[model samples]
Target: MRMLRQLLYRLIISLRTFRKKGLRAGFAELGRTISRIFYQRAEFIVIARALLEQIPPAASKQGLVIRRATTREEIASLSPIADMIDMARFHKMFDHGSFAFIAFQNDQPVGYCWVSEEVDRNVTRVQPPLHPGDACVHDLFVSPAHRGRRIGRALVSHRLRFLREHGYKRALAVVRRDNVPALKVDKKTGYTNIGEMSHTRILFWDSFRYNIPDA
Candidate 1:
């Protein structure tokens, strides 16, 4: 089912590219899409570390309201805007006591991010294993139309503050090596590059190897 959805998305993209560019461009895009879905691909993931003291004190969103998501209504409100998370996963995160920070602009959802506050409990998706006093932050996203406005940076800053206020000693954020925007946001929020990871997927299974500095 997941693969089918991916193929469907690719098909839609290819068609759009075809309509806008030409047949040659569409075929090239489709070929690349198929290769990605079926062939082995190398993915670089970066691990960043942040201490509580690293959070910026002046981190604030201009004309935007952000808060912890604590209600089913908020989950429903985010399902359409957040592409990476689903309704079921949102409920599970809530049940596990891992809450999300939702950002809204003029009553419309613009961006959101999630944090696993408890290192030991209800953490269904953690990689490289979290150490004591360590928490994982994942899936920070902003609407495309709202990009270039620093909304993502503000969202990450807000999340870091949340972790600091909750007394967590350390926070770990995983970002792809090619995600320039996320890397910039994480850096601006006082996170430092600590390690790199190589990832590859074979069918449904993924394998990762960590490369800590000096390790």
Candidate 2:
């Protein structure tokens, strides 16, 4: 039942996108559906954010020691999270100017978040305007064992405060539309729904589209 509902939702959104974006976008969305049937999957991505000047308290209030992992050794401390994260890929992105924030509890890594000053448009072909102070949240994860601890919310809140202190005006985050819990946490932490994006992965090739607000 859940899967069926999601399919229907995708269909509706795709049709709406087609009507708004014209033939080229229509064909692109059609290709995404066709590719999915061939085992090449795609997903709708939600872009949300907090204006740092007026951020709110965390949805799940918890005290944690969050540190920016810039060096290789600091990042290695997150090996406990290796099951879900690829260390090599993390290293590459870090080298490419992305930053990582690791949260520690009782001296063990509990969660981590990645951010970048650049508004990440790698997922889409569209070239939208970017604000210099915008820091895009690339990923956020909390271990399943520590799920109820409100660690995710803590991480986000801390990151926002850090960005604000360092001169960032706003922060952006990417979440799947289906991730209800995350969306809720984001809202509680002062992130407003800003945009939607989707990307198709076919073998080594990828295509993307992001709906710019009022565009």
Candidate 3:
């Protein structure tokens, strides 16, 4: 009954979005929202500066090069991962202080991830207060053809090292409980489960939100 009610609510929102933004935009937003609600059961994890030293050095895979994206061309090459947004919006994210790391395999872009030191309270659903030394990792994606390789591990390790070098003391990430692969990768990179959070939304408004105590 609860699931049915949620579906009906989502249908209403999608219809409204369609009238305002057209079918493509409305369906895309609906898909993203549904996916989030489906994965609402998530774990929040944090890695301390001390654990940074304990993490094993990321293995160097042949033909794989991981580096921070600094150019529009490099960012544009990440279209596979950022297909949901236009190039203009992608540039805006960079302009807003969200940094990206791109993975290339023999010159072909395969995967990428993004990190931000400050929360964009206006855009993000969950506005967790970030301390001076804390950074959040989000939007980690790997191409279907490149799964099972430790590309994600390397990307995460690179981000953590970058944060530590810049004087940050901790890194935080959220992973859906059902996403076993992501959970394993984060654990392998030394992130400890810290807590959990879930958000409930009706139309455009968040109805309920709370954190779960760690067991």
Candidate 4:
């Protein structure tokens, strides 16, 4: 029943996207949404501050400069690379005390990530709320032109170091279970599986969420 409902929802969304953005963009978006719903589940991972090893030499040699985004203007600058809606959300996250990092390659923004000591209610609502010393890393993205160069790994390493320096004891990251590349990167960077989460929405109305222990 749930699977059928999800398929129906995807159909509706794809039709809507097709109407708004044309066939190619619509199908692309639909493919991504359906892939996540059917093939991916969310996994929560934890990495202790003390266990965060040094950033790899490859990451260091990439000549990427990373810095925290501090103002609306800085957040707005991400528009060239990020969707406007996403930049707006990041601005809101900044207002809520979340730390945002931007990575630059030769003076152009190539990637970014966000870290927060508390969950953004606008985002996912985690059960067993975040502890005082826990930091959540979210919205990690690297430009397609710069991928496969260890840029994502470098972003995670830099965030871990930032959290450690700021007195956070552990860092938390959530990734889709079937995202082999992301999962491999997380494990290579020392994140350990801690739990799994799932969400179900009905008719754009009431929603249900489940948090399960990691086996």
All candidates' lDDT scores? 0.72, 0.68, 0.69, 0.68
- lDDT (tens digit, per residue) of candidate 2 on 1-215: 32344345556657877899987897787777555644553454455564546555465434567789979888888878763225655665677788899988778898898877654443212223357777777568888777778888888888888887788876766677788778877787777766677766554456767775822
Residue-by-residue lDDT tens digits, candidate 4, 98-179:
8788888898999888887776566434322466677778778888888888888888888887776777776777665566
Candidate 1 deviates by what RMSD?
A: 4.2
Candidate 3, poorest ten consecutive residues by summed lDDT: 42-51
Best candidate (score: lDDT): 1
TM-score order, best first, reads 1, 4, 3, 2
lDDT of 1 at 131: 69
Model 2 misplacement above 4 A:
1-39, 50-63, 119-129
Error of 3 at 192 (Å): 0.6
Per-residue lDDT tens digits for candidate 3, residues 30-49, read: 89767755554333443223
Off by over 4 Å in 3: 1-56, 86-89, 212-215
Consecutive 10-residue window with the lowest summed lDDT within model 4: 40-49
The best candidate by TM-score is 1
lDDT of 1 by residue, 67-96 (tens): 888887877789667533255566677777
Q: Which order, best to worst by lDDT?
A: 1, 3, 4, 2
If both were scored by TM-score, which would come out higher, candidate 3 or candidate 4? 4
Indicate whether candidate 1 or candidate 4 has the larger TM-score: 1
